[model samples]
Target: MTKEEREQIATCIREEIETLRETVARLEDSAKTVDLDQPIGRLSRMDSLTNQGISGKVLAESKRRLLGLERALANVDDEDFGHCEECGEPIPVRRLLIMPEASLCVDCAE
Candidate 1:
């Protein structure tokens, strides 16, 4: 990748990391264990539990993506930063712009 492209990807990754951090924080609050003794209807309790489970899953995924973005940002200046780890080919700039954390080219990722 060109210097400009690498810088752009780094910037995009930073922005995404910030957004994901906020999302993860909100998810953490929503994913807390439901209080069974709250005296609500059984169905309502079930719904709360289900929402909590979904939030937990989303939180996990957001955290994973956050970590990936951090790693990509850390390595953005490396000589091989834009090269696909799986095939050792240059990854497309458009793909990197869309997913700055990607380590594999589209072909290898598929």
Candidate 2:
């Protein structure tokens, strides 16, 4: 990829990392607000627990994505940043735009 394209992808990845950090912070705050000891109906507690579980999973996924984005940003200037690691083919710019963290072409990923 061209230098401009690599820079663009790096910018996008940084933005995504920032957004995910905000989401993770919010999820952590919400989890902290959950009170199991407070007097509440059993069903309500169950619902709260269920929501907490879902939130935990979402937070985990966000963290994972953040790591990927950070890795992509770190490698943005690499000679083969926009190439498929498996086949050594150029990855489409469109795919890279859509998924700045991707390191493989569609065929290789599949």
Candidate 3:
């Protein structure tokens, strides 16, 4: 990728990281256990638990993506920043812009 592309991807990655941080925080709160002692119908309690479980799963994914983005940001300036790890080829600039944490090209990823 060009120097300008790299810089742009870096900026995008930073912004995504910030947004993911906020999402993770919100998910953490939502993922907390539902208060079973609350004076709610059993069906409502079940629904609350289900929602909490979904939130927990989303939180885990967000955290995983956040870590990947952080690692990508740390290596954004490296010589092989945009190279596919498996194919030793340059990854597409568009892909990097959309998913800065990706270490593989589309074909290799597939």
Candidate 4:
């Protein structure tokens, strides 16, 4: 891929990471905003906890994504970004655009 294209992909990943971080922060803030046992609040608070749990999962997934993006970017620097780590062939640019963290090309992945 072109250098500009690679930079654009990196920018997109960074923006996504920032957005997920904000979502996680908001979930945490909402989770802490109410008491857990008040009559009008019990079930609702539980619901908040549920949302927080989901958000926490998203947060974890986002963190994993950021790590992968870092590795992918490093691969770019090392001139190994577009090659499948497992089989040593070129990875399609389309696939990389769709999933920048992919370490294996489609054949290897399958």
Candidate 5:
């Protein structure tokens, strides 16, 4: 991909990471506010905690994706952004368009 296109995708990835961080923080705060000692509170807290756990997991996954995107941006800075790291071949534009964070080409990924 072109440098301009890479920059645009990097910007979008950063924005998405920021949004996910905010959501993760909100879920964590909400989970903490739930009291677990009251009669019905225990059940409610359990449910809330479970939901929070799932959200937290998703957030962790998002963070991983963000890290990958950061690395991709670094690759752009190094002038290797569109090349497969493992094979040193040009990664398809379509794949990069769909997943800007990709480090491996389709063959390597499989």
Candidate 6:
């Protein structure tokens, strides 16, 4: 990839990592604030617990993506940064723009 392209991808990844971190922080705070012993009814507490579970799952996925983005940033200048890991083919720039952390091409991802 060209130097400019690599820089662009790195920027995108960094921005995404920042956004994901903020979201994960917010989710963590929300999870912490969930109170089961409040004056709310049983159904309300159950609903809160269910929402907490969903938020936890989403937070985990976001953190995983954040890690992936950080790895992409670290390898932004690697010779194979934009290549498909499974096929050793060039991953399209458009795809890379959409998913800066992707390591597999569309066909391999399927």
Cα error, candidate 4, residue 56 (Å): 0.9
* Candidate 4 Cα errors over 4 Å, as ranges: 1-40
Write the residue-wise lDDT of candidate 4 on 30-85 in tens digits. 65765656666667767877877777777677667767876776666556777898
- Give the poorly placed runs of model 1, Cα more than 4 Å off: none
Report lDDT (Cα) of residue 56, candidate 3: 84
- Per-residue lDDT tens digits for candidate 6, residues 3-110, read 888888888888898899999999999999997778999898999999999999999999999988999989888998999999999898888888999999999999
**True-structure RMSD for candidate 6:** 1.0
Which candidate has the highest lDDT of all?
3
User: Regarding lDDT, does 2 or 3 come out ahead?
Assistant: 3
Greater lDDT among 5 and 6 belongs to 6
lDDT per residue as tens, model 3, 1-110: 78899899999999999999999988877665467788999899899988888888888999999999999999999999999999989999999999999999999999
Model 2 agreement with the true structure over 10-106: per-residue lDDT tens digits:
7888888899999999999999999889999999999999999999999999999888889888888888788899999999988988898888999
C-alpha lDDT (0 to 100) for residue 11 of candidate 5: 72
lDDT of 4: 0.74
Per-model TM against the reference: 0.94, 0.94, 0.95, 0.71, 0.73, 0.94
**lDDT agreement with native, every candidate:** 0.91, 0.90, 0.92, 0.74, 0.73, 0.91
Output the lDDT of residue 77, model 1.
96
Give the Å error, residue 34, model 5: 3.8
Q: Which is the winner by TM-score between candidate 3 and candidate 5?
A: 3
State in Å the error of residue 8, model 1. 0.7
Error of 4 at 1 (Å): 4.7
lDDT of 1 by residue, 1-110 (tens): 77888889989999999999999988887665577789999999999988888888889999999999999999999999989999999999999999999999999999
